[model samples]
Target: MTTKSIPDILRQSLESHMAEADLRDDDELKELLGKLNTLSGKVAAAKAQVMARRSDKKR
Candidate 1:
């Protein structure tokens, strides 16, 4: 299987549903929101790691 980022997965899922004229239930939306929260944390962690590496290289 190919690896896809969380945002890409989310976008593709939503786009497919949109094309099919399907409605999302509250529970399904909630799960997507949870995924978004997880993505946010991952982004923050990556930013911190990059900053730390840059700081180290500057020293």
Candidate 2:
């Protein structure tokens, strides 16, 4: 069986946790939003690194 990718696994886990949380509470929602932003930044950086490596291989 093929293994799930890191991004896919992270997205699934985040969705599951978000569904369980009380988003109606402003404080909790704000915290979750902050965490999401941090995760997004990390994912973007990882993508950039992968792209850079791919470009280097062509040189």
Candidate 3:
């Protein structure tokens, strides 16, 4: 069986639904993901901090 590659439209949709994530092409997507991967921990930490602040303000 052969596997099909992901389409650009699907990638665009996914990125739009993500954290304002976007890319111009497959190569750009690859590069963007690589950079994001390296900053994943920081991203998660920042998200958690923002969430915590929101929760604290709500209560």
Q: What is the C-alpha lDDT of each candidate?
A: 0.73, 0.68, 0.59
- lDDT score of residue 45 within candidate 1: 78
lDDT of 3 at 6: 34
Residue 23 lDDT in model 2? 35
TM-score rank, highest first? Answer: 2, 1, 3
- Candidate number with the higher lDDT (2 or 3): 2
Candidate 2: tens digits of C-alpha lDDT, residues 1-59:
44555655665576666688823446865576667667867877887798899999999
Best by TM-score: 2
lDDT of 1 by residue, 1-32 (tens): 43566765775787678668685656877688
Model 3: ten consecutive residues of lowest lDDT: 1-10
- Score every model by TM-score: 0.58, 0.60, 0.39
Candidate 3's residue-wise lDDT over 1-59, tens digit each? 43322343444455775645443446767676656555654656676798899999999
Off by over 4 Å in 1: 1-25
lDDT of 1: 0.73
Q: Cα deviation of 10 in candidate 2 (Å)?
A: 11
Give the distance in Å from residue 20's predicted Cα in candidate 2 to where it truly belongs.
18
